[model samples]
Structure formats: C-alpha cells, structure tokens
Target: MSKGERMKTTAREKIKQQQAAQRQREKRRRVVTYAAVGVVALAAIGGGWLYAASRSQSEEAAGGDQAPVTVQSDGSVVMARSGVEKPVLDVYEDFQCPACKQLETVSGQTFKNLAAEGKAKVVYHPISIFQREPTRGNSLRAGAAARCVADGRQWLAFHDILYKNQPSETVEGFKTNDLVTWGKEAGVTSPDFEQCVTSQKHAQAQLSYADKVIKEQKIEGTPTVKLNGVALEGNVAFTPQQLRDQVTKAAK
Candidate 1:
C-alpha cells in the first residue's frame, strides 16, 4: 500500500479506460458508414425506376407511323395502324371470318363516319384463315383478291363489299371469274384485273404477313383485335357500343 505503487496502478487503469473509449469511437464510425451506404442505395434504386418510366413515356410519344401494308403493287392501297391522335382502333379481321362480317354489318356507316371525320382511325388487319382453296370462302384467295382491288384506289369500296357478301365456309362468296364484275362495283376497271386475280402473286405476301402477325402477337383465333395493343376478350363477339366504351376508357 505504498503511495508510489498506488499511483502506478491508477495509471494502468487510466490507460485501459482510454483504449476502451477509442474502440467505442471506431464502432460508431463504422455504424455511421453503414447507415450512409444504405441511404445511398435507396436513392439509387428510386432514381433508376424514375428513369425507366420517363424513357417509356418518351418512346410512346415518339411512336411513328405504321408501315404501309401492301394490298396494292403501286404502294397506293396501303393498310396500316392509323396514327390519328385520339381513339384509334387497330382491328385484326379475316375477310371470310363470319364474326368480322357481323361486326362490319353492325358498325358499317358508324365506323365509316368516324373514319371520314378523323375522330377515329380503323386499321383493318385482313387475315385469311376461313378462306382457303376448294372450300375457298375464308382463306388466302380472298385476301389476295382484296389486295388486287385495293391496289387500284378502291380500298374502301372493296372492303365493304367483301364483308357484306362474305361467302360462308361451304360457299366461296364471289367466284374467281366474278372478280372482274366485283372490281367494277368497286370502281376498278381492268381487263388486267382478272389476270391479277388468277395470277395469285399476292398470296406470297399474304401468307408471309399472317405468319409474322401470329408469331409476333401470339394471336390464336380469327378477328383478334387490339386497342392500343392491349388484347381483349377474343372468344366472343364485341359490339360497337362496347368498343366505344373501351376507346373512351383507354383514352382516359
């Protein structure tokens, strides 16, 4: 219990206390570093999400006109996705598809008026499933012939008549020889028209297009349609009234 010994012991204790304090300060520094790292990570994730959303909007706005589909060789009878500002309908229909015929019959002038006024744009995707050879009402033959009429500036007329008299699965609506007669009804006069109908050159294009559409969009049935590329109920028929409602809702 000498005073010098007591002083030495106290000094050792003081050194131990100082080391413990330094350890605590290092621990605090580490805690602060981890907290700062977490905050930075959260901010980065938030920024990435915002950037992706903004880029999507920019791309949507920059969407260009659809490429002109070749219903005609002159590049005139062009069918495409209409880029008209509000309430554009992009419809996929087969010329021999009975459902499509029904829709056209129901929405005929109403649709025509909408197109004429530019309030709506109707993009008809003429698919050829129901028109094939022999039982040739709903297959490639109808589609190619439609292209023939469309090539000469009678697209609308051809569209209407073809739908109106859509031949049933058993009966080909208009005979091949009768195409010349039908062309006159659509205002296209060509001795060459019959030759084109018989030529079957347009079949190559139609088949290629149908294959492309099926692969890209995953469409399964006839009259598959989309409003702004959003697929809807395909098994049943939809009326014009329902279509109008969908257009309004989508625009909103």
Candidate 2:
C-alpha cells in the first residue's frame, strides 16, 4: 500500500482507542454515583428500623391498662411469722422453661407440703421470659390477670397454670386466649383478664422483676433455686425425699 493510505488507517485506529477510553471513564463514574446513593438509602432504612424498635419497647415498658405492682418488703413472697423464721427456700424460675416445670411438679410440691405442715417456708422469685417461645402460662399476662381475679387470694393457681401449659420452644402452640379460659375454668371471675393478656401490660412488672433478679440475684439461667442465698443447679427432681435432702443440706 502507499505511505499516505497506511498513515490514514493508523490515525483512524488511534481515534477509536481514544473513544474507548472515554467511554470506560464515564462508566466508572456512573457506577460510583449509584453506589453512594445505595449507601444513603440503606442508612435511612436502618435509622427508621431502629426508631420503630425503640418505640415498641417503650410501649411494652409502659404496660398500658395494668395496675401498678407493689414490691414485697422482703423481695420475696414467703410469709414470715413471729418466732418462726420460716427456713426459706427462694426459687427463681421462667414459665417457659421445661426444666422449671420439672422442678415445680417434682420438687416444688414437696416444698409446699413442708410449708403447709409448718416445717419450712418457700419464696417464689419468678423471672419473666414471657416472650420466649413455649411460655405456656404466658405467665406475665396470666399473673397480672390472676392478681386482678383472686385479689391476691389465689396467686398459687395462676402460678400452677403457667407451668402446666408450657409449650415447646421448637413450635408455636400455646394459646394466649386459652390461658384466660383456663383462669375462668379455675373459678377466677375477672372479665378484663383477657384484655390485659392481649395488651402485654402484665409483662411490664415481669420485665422489671427480671432486671432486678438479674442485677441483684446474679441469676444467669432459669430454674435456679437458692436456699438462704446458696444456688441450686440441675433439675433437682422433686420427690419428697430429694427436696427434703436438699433442704436439710442447705439448712445446715
């Protein structure tokens, strides 16, 4: 080919390379701009979610429509009698806890029997993990309702029902409505009990109790039993003999 023709072809290829480079630079700029917008959008969404979460928590803390709870003087429910001293067994439990149910059905009865016989005393320090799955009693709500029902006369029945219906954590089967029906079946006559359960107002005091128990009692797990401040670990299968033995050991 002639020199002039070859020179023209080379110049055209150089111009094509320049155009490609400009297109590449523009593409890079567009991608960077898109990424910045995405980051900004994500930050906004995160902020909104955080705000909503805080609001929900605040509502739960307020526990609308529930009456206020008065903390017991000794921080326990075990009755104290003059000159009796009532050798105390303090129990911290979660209503959803299966092991807690075991402790109740097997060992708590023995302790209650002893208390009934005036041989000892028992104090229940219920820790509310009410939101935890399998909380058959929906104890926080139920306890609050029962408090309204028995007017403080039959808290024990409320306590029993909470444990009796504890559902499995693996599945969702416990009916909050059924708990109210159960209370009525047990002879409690409060019409507003169901409302309290639905509103989750009863959980307020329970949440407060949990905070106190964790901070003061240093409780890390459910079904923790303490006799005069000494902690009990394991299921502690409740039989008259086992409870009697543990109590005897703790008393000493």
Best by lDDT: 1
Candidate 2 wrong stretches, greater than 4 Å: 1-76, 79-83, 130-153, 233-239, 248-252
Residue 210 in model 1: lDDT: 71
For each candidate, the alpha-carbon lDDT, in order, equals 0.62, 0.61
Q: Write the per-residue lDDT of candidate 2 for residues 1-252, one digit (tens) a residue.
A: 999999999999999999999999999999999999999989999999876454332111122222212235322355322243446677787766787887777665565555554445677776765554345345455444433443332355566776787767675543567767766666566667767655655555666767788789888777787766777554343334555667666556
Show where candidate 1 strays beyond 4 Å. 1-86, 131-138, 151-153, 234-237
- Candidate 2, position 55, lDDT: 32
Q: Please report, as a residue range, the 10-residue window in candidate 2 with the lowest summed lDDT.
A: 58-67
Model 1: per-residue Cα lDDT over 30-129, one tens digit each: 9999999999999999998876444332111113433333353421233433565556565677777787776676554444544444445556667655
Clashes of each: 4, 2
C-alpha root-mean-square deviation, candidate 1: 14.7
TM-score to true structure, per model: 0.60, 0.59
Highest TM-score against the true fold, candidate? 1
